[model samples]
Target: MVAGIQLRIGILTQREIPSESEGSEERAKVHVSINPFPSLIPSELSKMSTEKERETHVYLAKLAEQAERYEEMVESMKQVAKLDVELTVEERNLLSVGYKNVIGARRASWRIMSSIEQKEESKGNEHNVKLIKGYRQKVEDELSKICSDILTIIDKHLIPSSGSGEATVFYYKMKGDYFRYLAEFKTDQDRKEAAEQSLKGYEAASATANTELPSTHPIRLGLALNFSVFYYEIMNSPERACHLAKQAFDEAISELDTLSEESYKDSTLIMQLLRDNLTLWTSDLPEDGGEDNPKAEESSKSAEAQEH
Candidate 1:
């Protein structure tokens, strides 16, 4: 005699069968269907190989950068660095330096924006303040993480290799920017320390650029402009600011004059910004002390008006 049998099935669950009937002593048979959704669970999904994870993060980072979501890009790149442990020393150093730049810029942007937000709050701009609060909070949280990660990358990767000239210059420049922003948004002690670091970084970049880059290099002019700002705004040293700005302004004007209008088009913004800085710093100098450059000042004002 044959015994009755029962079977049960459920989605993504094991099949169940009733035991054989006692009198007949018949055997029970059970079979499981293939899992239609194999990667449903977190564990299964996370089983992606390390290389794949690194590639995914790298792709995400590129997308984030294109979207101008710099903090997200930086974080994703950091993940790529963490997972790409098998990369060559040069590759790892390059990746770490690039990661540091993104993190530094993100942190600096947050610090600058937060400072502006505080100013807005002080001015009783409640509506704008409310609109930016969520964004400000998000950036603040990311900044805390970025600060720690930047130091780790520098200490572990950059310092070990001593970096190439270009990489080292970029590293110090970004480091200066990070500290400068930190000074502006944080405590007085940070201000002092950050000023010191900013000055040191700019000076190092300047020294490196003298050997590694041309006198007319855009990087050189940019470094000077930044250094001038650090002196004028952060250190409250107008004399030093004027000195650096004047040097940068002269170099930029000479460079600008040499380029064709078409070639100059690419550098218009940088030129305009350099002129603006020169005007700003010179105007702040003691009347007799500042070198008067009426032409440059007028040009900068015209550029400003056109931009508006």
Candidate 2:
């Protein structure tokens, strides 16, 4: 999601940001000319005092988003989050964007390595299997750290400081998303723990959405989108996934007229996503069985074993 801000002029500044990897001295110069939002002028940022550090970090985070320097963006947002103040919707979006991009690549890599490792093991290629396992473990470790750190921010700072239900729902949804990320690669006890935490987080968000948000709200719709995904992907419950997605989509469709112009695009976009997932999953559903279906059970068991 882009930080929705408008600006008229560019600010030229040099920043020394650390590399994504630990112990790296790499830095990049941020050309504010590329900033999507020019509403905040350079002079204003320059004249801000120490008390305005939050704004400065927020501005830098936006710049990093424009630069595709997600690590810096994540770092800057972490500082903003640590401030223990309620986050604006724009700031929350930037925070999610930063961590999502930073962790997304690693998740993709881990999945690829998992696939390759299975092939190597099946062929009895011990050497290649060992190497793939090692690299995959490193990726898993990084994913674990990222998820844990973000969860800490959500549980300790964001949730408590959230003065509005909108903010509460957003924070809980984010918590669920990161925990589901952990369940993607974690195994055994770790997988079980992540899955349970994910469910609790999504459940909390859903409960809040039921009373605190309108059906057509983007945050509510987004929560439905991801919560259904958790059921389908992590829990191996296509039926539940489809049910959740369809219910959310239908409810939102019924309330389409209530959607605000500001969130019309976002809410509609998520509704489309929900409908798409429902279509795909419903087509794959079993004819006359529930979670106890033998095929579903076998598939879930096989996937569980693969994580080990």
Candidate 3:
């Protein structure tokens, strides 16, 4: 199972962003009467006014996202971004959805290749080991480029234009997420720098979310969810992770009545995720010491629930 969950951000009534294909009807419903893609005369897009062109690109981007054609989505959103106007929440989500899918595949491949390389080295297969390492490096380079590109957009465009609100919190959360991806494979000083930057981004997001957004707001809960995850996975601080998760879960529970119908589903889903992690982490915590040893209680628990 995937160890941690990612935030599913979208406009009201939008379902969680699907990993595979989402219906084009749902996307088209979001924006009607827009021109479709190349099959329907691509030249007409250029002939449209700049405003119309931007609208077309945004529509295309959303459609590409639903189709999981992320490269096409990125191309279309890049055109939208070039207009240099403040991106609406849906546009920001579309941009992130595109880049994340593109980069996520590379990150997954790099991890698998790294594991294979280690096994090849153990088997004294130098040729296979070298090839795996080389491929992993290439994947890492691509990941770095993708992460850098998005981070630049967040700092240069998104952050400046987003004053103080959920948008600002959302941008900072994205900044942290990309930095965490960078820290996953980087080494030495580079890894340290990436980790520090990731921490800064998450911390800024937490501060802003706490002040500006309600406890039951999907963006705020999502920030807490990811920030606690950073503590556990990146910082190796299960104690801090549990504390943060518990705090957020508790606070959100207190405000459960305040959750609007539009956000109720996303908010509750994230809250459930936070609760699940808390259960996992708390059970794994060391019994006799302050130090967190997540594996300490695993064997006993496994023995109790053994199935063979």
Candidate 4:
């Protein structure tokens, strides 16, 4: 007779193991089985399989952005972008935008803090000034690195094709913004180089927009306004600034007449802003100058009256 022992494993059925007796006729039996852990049920297996489908990083990024936690938002967005799964073009674009926004915010913060540090230094608060300086340097270095990474992303993923008009326009516009911030915060030589780079970017964006979009498009008008500001404030060219401002204002007014009432209402604030810019830029021009340009004189008169 063979002695047998029964064994139960996990959720599997029980099986018997036979043991040899002293008699020569006794036989031994072998059992083969596979049993998953008792703790892993159907629901748990489903959850595990669906892990890649979870957009938790994206959700966290949006939440962090809403909370103004820019650094955390950047990290979350990076995690989302680096996932093992392939991303859609739209998703990649979103990641790029998130990085751009965070980098811009970081640059702006550093500028503000640097200004504060300068004020503190002027007040003879060496201790606080030193702390602020150190913090600002760290932020500047980190933001510079992030800016370079974003530029790479723009070049490689966002607008890999030079013929992609819309994407190229967006990329150059962002490049303009990045260089403008760099110009504002860098040393004299670096500032000049950054300013030149900024102008090049703005010009490229403007050219691409003019070629691909309508003259009265919001993007064209916005680009004109930005160029005006750049010329007036950064380049110290008041005449060019006034000319671009006038162009933007005229285009906005012309576009306004073609829109429906609802659309007109939606654009009213932008139109008002354009008008304000016209007035501001006109006032910035030399009172006794531009006598040879009749159009400029007429525009100046119109802007002065429109402000009321």
In model 4, how large is the Cα lDDT of residue 37?
55
Tens-digit lDDT string for candidate 2 (176-233): 8899999978889989999999999999999999999999988888888889888888
Ranking by TM-score: 2, 3, 4, 1
Candidate 2 segments exceeding 4 Å error: 1-51, 292-308
Estimate, for each residue in 20-127, the C-alpha lDDT of model 4 and write its tens digit. 474443344445455465578778876665454437777777787678776777676566544434444445445655666677678668868977987998899999
Q: In candidate 3, what are the lDDT values of residues 32-71, reduced to their tens digit? A: 2334453556556554666788899999998887898998
For model 1, where is the 10-residue window of minimal lDDT? Answer: 299-308
Tell me the spans in candidate 1 whose CA falls farther than 4 Å from its real position: 1-56, 80-145, 159-163, 255-268, 288-308
In terms of TM-score, how similar is model 4 to the real structure? 0.61
Query: Candidate 4: lDDT of 241?
Result: 72
Among these predictions, the greatest lDDT belongs to 2
Ranking by lDDT: 2, 3, 4, 1
TM-score list, all predictions: 0.56, 0.79, 0.77, 0.61
Clashing pairs in 4: none
In candidate 4, what residue range of length 10 has the lowest lDDT sum? 299-308
| Residue-pair clashes per candidate | 0, 4, 0, 0
Which pairs of residues collide in candidate 3?
A: none
